[model samples]
Target: MSLDQAAAVMEQQARACRNMAAPLYADLLVHTAEDVRAGGPCADAVAGWTGAPSTAAVPLRLLGGVHALVLTGQAPQLARFYPSAGGAYRPEDADAAWAAFRAVVADRRDAVRGWLRRPPQTNEVGRANLLLAGLLHAVQESRGLPVRLVELGASAGLNLRADRFRVAAPGFAWGPEDSPVRLPGAWRDGVPGWLREAARSYPELTVVERLGCDVTPLDPGSEDGALALRAYLWPEHTARATRLGGALELARRVPARVDRVGAAEFLAGLDPRPGTLTVVWHSVMRQYVPADEWARVTAELDRLAAAGAPFAHLLFEPYEQDGRHRFQLRARIGAGPERVLAEAHPHGLPAWTV
Candidate 1:
């Protein structure tokens, strides 16, 4: 890519980070994009990143590498700007931090390049609240049948243990109150009557099978895996980091199998079981899937739904509405039309019931 084109992508990512409530990342990425244009270490690290702009996610991957260095105590100067290292994020310190970041990249070119080559796996546990809300809605509609969940792009499969996490809205709550992963005040508005009823009727779901697929899955039990997962989270978001730690602990006790396969390939091999609700779910992952493969995934979903078995497809993804980006919880059960359950935060908190 041309220097101008690369800079444009970085600038676009910076804007997105700012909109997504990650000012620290926005400042660093904005500076990194300028450094790229000026022919420096930042540009060298991101060299050969040929993915399309929409699917690149290059900025986060680069940031993750830097964060890893900071976490490992390899970049002490840069650590002062990272909240995860017990430092405060001041916008005025961003310029000095960027210089330190460039120096780190220059000194650790090989390590940074390795990170850029790998796809980012955040494995956000907070999103499980929104995913569980969708599952509860489906369970209620299916009349409390045991659910067999199949998740695409499951990352570390941390969310497979979502049922074990607690969530609280204004007037309703679900899961164990004493659970390690607690999502207090999860919803933006008052919980809907349907959700309340579902939570009341079934405080916990009967999940017979928990299976997930990802082209590259991380093992939450491994030290390297845990480090990589934590590195992707913005240092400023302490709640998210804490939640991830809890989810990792949960994963140790209750293990979920995540297959190393693409989404379409995994779906093609799945067969819905009788006397159980077969639910296919994904969150914030559809954007990474290619159009042709996603089309195949949709066809497979339709085929599974038509097999005379109880089935549901749930998604938490961004949908453009009225010229704005809104992440929505949508579901399709059996042959029924799609339903928009709620609008949610990207990290899966503060859901507004619709």
Candidate 2:
């Protein structure tokens, strides 16, 4: 691909970053687009890619690589401007930040190039806010049976421990009170009154098993794996960084198995256990799956339902609504029709009643 076209992609991502409240990433991406147009080290790092620059989440991968350098203390000068690196962004320091970032791309070309090849996997903990709510509905539907949590495209399975995190909103609360990963204002306008019955339908969820699948599953307990998860988070979003820290700790304490397999194959290998609520869950990752593979996954869900196993499919995936994308929490219980339970931010914070 021509550098100009690649540069436009970066600029497009910058617009998205700005809209997502990541101004630091937006500014840096502008500089990155310029660097790409100039055929600088950024171009060299992405040289190996042939099909398309966006095939590997080009912009996020590039930013994640730079974030890794800051997190690892390999780019101290650049780290000084990254919030997640314990530094702050200053407009006056923009030129210096770009210089340091470019130097990292130039000097650590191999490292940056390696990051370019890997897809960005953030394993966002905030999304657990929506996951937990859906689990609540599942638990209620299963007649309070023990939950068997199965997730598709679960990166490090940080969110597999969703039940372990504490979620609180106005006049509502759930999960352990003393939990480290505290999610406040989980529901928009303080837990909508319409869904109070479902929220209180079950005393508590009893999770018996936690299993997930990813083409490339990450080990949260390992340093390299953890760094990859952290690197993908927007550096300016300190709240997400803190939430990740808590989720990582929860992952250590809460044992969950993430199989290194495709979502369809993973679902194909499982049978629902009797007297247990099999809750199949996934979030945001649905977009990456091929249409045929995703159809197979849905078919597997259908198989489980036909088997007469108490099952629920809870997902937080984007759906087109009114000519735009909407991140929705959809749930299905025991072959019943799927229900659109709620809506939330892309990061899955502050959900509102549908």
Candidate 3:
């Protein structure tokens, strides 16, 4: 992509970051984008980026690299801009931070480019609350049988442990109350009756198998893998970071396997079992997939549905509704009609039941 196009995309991503409660990252990315347009060190650091500017997540990858530097204590000067590192965010400090950021990029140009070569793997454990709710809805419809879950784009596979994480909303709660990973502010509207019943009747899921696939799956047990996951998170969002830590600990106790395979290839090898509810789930990952591969993935989903074993497909993705981008939970069981279950924040908090 041209420098101009990349700059514009970064600017748009900056606005999105601000809207999503990441002002620090938004400010840093805005400056980075400007520096790129001005043909400076930041431009050189991003010179090797070859993915589509619009959807490559280029801005986030760059930010992740810088965040990694701060996390690893490689750039002490940049620590003042990171709230998670005990720095306070002041609107006036953005300019000085930008200068420091640019200097760091120039000094660590090769390291920054290395980050751009890989996709951001946020894992985003907070999103598990929404996915768990969707799973419960599917279970209620499918005779409450044990489920075998196969997730696409599972990243570190943290959400595979969703059933083990604590979830609380007004008038409802699920999972272990004492669990370290707590997801509060779960629903904007009151919890639905279906969800309440599902939680009450089946407090813990009988997950027979949990399998996931990603183009590059991260092992939560590895130091580098943990660093990558943490770096992708906006440093100012302490809650998300805490939840990730909890998920990592939980992953050590309750293990799940994530294969290094493409989504379509993973689905092609899956088949339904007669007595189990075979559920395919993914969250906020469909956009990154190529159209041709996604077409094949859809066909595989149809094949699973038609296989006659109890089946469900749950997805949480951005859907344009009335000219607004809203993330919605959608579910399809067997050959039944697709249902729009709820609308949710991009991070899966404060869901509004439909």
Clashes of each: 0, 0, 0
**Residue 302 CA displacement from its true place in model 1, Å:** 0.6
Instruction: Say which prediction, candidate 2 or candidate 3, comes out ahead on TM-score.
Output: 3
The CA lDDT at 194 in model 3 is: 80
Candidate 1, residues 1-354: lDDT per residue as tens digits? 676688788889899889887888899889888988888888888877734474778888899998998999999998998888887778888888888988999999999888887788888887887888889999998999999988999999999989999998766778987788999878886887778888888888889989999999999999999999999999889888989999999999987999999999999999889899999999999999999999999999998989989999999999988998899999999978989999888888888887
Q: Give the per-residue lDDT of model 3 (tens digit) for 28-48.
A: 889888888999888888877
CA lDDT of every candidate:
0.88, 0.87, 0.89
Candidate 2: list runs displaced more than 4 Å: 53-55
TM-score of each candidate? 0.97, 0.96, 0.97
Off by over 4 Å in 3: none
Local distance difference test, candidate 1 = 0.88
Give the RMSD in angstroms, all C-alphas superposed, for model 3: 1.2
Q: Report the C-alpha lDDT of model 2 over 21-126, residue by residue, as the tens digit.
A: 9888888889989988888888887766634736457889889988998999999988989989889987788788888888999999988888887889999899
